[model samples]
Target: MELTLANVMGLVRQTFADPRGAAQVVLRLPMPLQARWAAVALMAVLSAVLMHLMSGLMPPAVGPDGQVLPAISPFFWAGMVGFGMVMTALLAFVVGRWRGGRGELADSVILVAWLQFIQLLIVVVQLVVLVALPVLAPIVEVGAVLIFLWLLVNFVAEMHGFRSLGMVFLGIVLTFVLAVFGMTILLMLIGVAP
Candidate 1:
C-alpha cells in the first residue's frame, strides 16, 4: 500500500473488520524510523487541533467542584499526546519482550502511529455526531471507547505475536494500574498530589 487516501480508507474499514489483520498491514509497511516518528508527531498535532475545535463547539464542561473548567490549550494536548505515543510504544516493546514475545521497537512505533490515525478518524465522527445527532452522542462516546480498546488490544497482540487477547488485555490493565500508581507517587513527591 502506498499510503494513498483510498488505501488508508480501505485500511480503516479493514481495521473495523479485523483489527489484528489491519495491525499486521501497518506493521509491515516499509516506513523508516524517522518517518514513523514524524507520523506520530503529526497525528498528535492534528488530534490536538481537532480536540480544541471540538471543545469550542461543545458546551463548557463542569468540574466536580461545580466550576466550569477552562479549556485546555492545543499545545498542551499536543505535548501530552506526543509523549503518550512515545511512551506507549516504548512500554509495549519493553514489556512484550519481557513476556517472551517477539517484536521490534520499530513495529511498536508504527502500530502506535497507525492507532493514532484511527483515533483521529473517530474524533471526526464524534464531532459530526455531536453536531447533527446530539441524542446519539452518548452512544458514539461509548462506541469510541470500545473501538479504541478493541483496536489497542489487537494491535498489541499482533505486534507481540501474542495468541490470546485475554492475556493482552490483562497485561494492559496491569500496566495501566502500575503507571497510575507510579505517576501518583511522583506527583506526591513533587507536592502536586490531588
Candidate 2:
C-alpha cells in the first residue's frame, strides 16, 4: 500500500488494535529505505524539540556561579537519531535472524520507524499534559514508557515472525545492553568519562 495519510492513520489504528498484524502489514508495504530513514530522522528531531520545550518548563540547570547551562546542540540530536536508527535496525536484523526469522534490514527499519512515530504521538500527549497539568507529567511519562515497551515487544515479534514474545523481549534487552556498552566505550574514547 501507498504511504498516504489515510493509510498511515489506518495503520496506526491497526497497531493499537493488533500490533503484530500491523507490523506484518507494514512489512508488506513498498516503503523505501530512504523514506523510512527520513521518517526516523524527522521523529528524532521532533522528539528532541519537544523534550527541550518540556525542559524549559522546569528550573534551569545552573552552574556554581548562578549561570544557566546551555542546552544541547542540534547536531547532537542528529547524531543521536542517526545512531539510534542504525543500531535499532542492526539489532533487529541480527537478533531476528538468530531466532530463525526471515526479516530483512528494510523490514526492521520500517518497524523502528513506526515505533518512533507512535512514541512521537505519545510525546505530544505528554507535552499537552505537562502544560495543562504539570503534576501528571510524571505519571504520563511512566505510562508512555510502559506502552512503548509493550508495543515494541509485539512489533519486534511480528516483524521477525517469532512465536514467542519472550524471544523478542530478550532481543530488546540484549540490544539495549550492547548499546549502553558501546556508548560507554564511545564516551570513554572521547574523554567524556573518567
Candidate 3:
C-alpha cells in the first residue's frame, strides 16, 4: 500500500479497530531495512517537534520545590526519542528471539516507528482538545494511554507471531520494569539521580 494521507488515515482507523491487523499491514510495507531506520528517525523528530509545540501551549512544569523546571530542547528530545526507538527495536528483536519469537530487527523497527506515528496523531488530537476544550484534555490523556498500551501489545504480538495477547502484554510489562530498573542502576553507577 502507498503512504498517502488517505491510506494513513485508513490505517489509523483500522488500527483502532484491529491493532494486530494494522501491525501486519505495517510490517508488509515495501521498505528496506535502512528505510525502516530512517522512518524511525523521522517519526522521532516529528514527535519531538509536536512535543515542543505542545509544551509552548501548556504552562511550565513546577518542581517539588516550587521552582519552574527548564524546558527541554526539541533537539535533545529528538535524539532521546531516536535512541529509544532504536533500543526498543533492538531489545524486542534480541529478547523476542530468546523467547522463541520469529521476528526480525527490521520488522521491530518499522512497527515501533509506526507506533510512534500513531502516537503523533493522538498528540495532535490532544493538542486540539487542549486548545478547543481544555476540560476534555484529561479524558484525551486517558484515552491516549489506553491506545498506546493497546497498540504496543498488539504490535509486539504481531511482530513476534505470538497468538496470546495476554502473554505479550505481560512480557511488555516485565521488560519495561526491567528496563527502568536497569536504567536506574546505570544512572546510579554514573552518579546521576534518576
TM-score of each: 0.94, 0.87, 0.94
Q: Report the poorest 10 consecutive residues by lDDT, candidate 2.
A: 73-82
In candidate 1, stretches whose alpha carbon ends up further than 4 angstroms from where it belongs are: 62-69
Per-residue lDDT of candidate 2, residues 1-194 (tens digit): 88789988999899889989888888887778898778777777876776667677777889999999887666676578667777887888888888798888888888888888888888889879988998999999999988888888897787777888887888798889987898899999999955
Report, for every candidate in turn, its global Cα lDDT versus the true structure.
0.91, 0.83, 0.92
RMSD of each: 1.6, 2.1, 1.4
**Per-residue lDDT over 68-94 for candidate 1, one digit per residue giving the tens place of the 0 to 100 score:** 998999999999999999988998889
Q: How many steric overlaps are in each model, in order?
A: 0, 0, 0
Q: Against the hidden true structure, what lDDT does model 2 obtain?
A: 0.83
Of candidate 3, the 10-residue stretch with the lowest lDDT total is 87-96
Steric clash pairs (candidate 1): none
> If candidate 2 were superposed on the true structure by all CA atoms, what would the RMSD be?
2.1
Q: Say what the RMSD of model 3 is.
A: 1.4
Could you tell me how far off, in angstroms, the CA of residue 127 lies in candidate 2 after the best superposition? 0.7
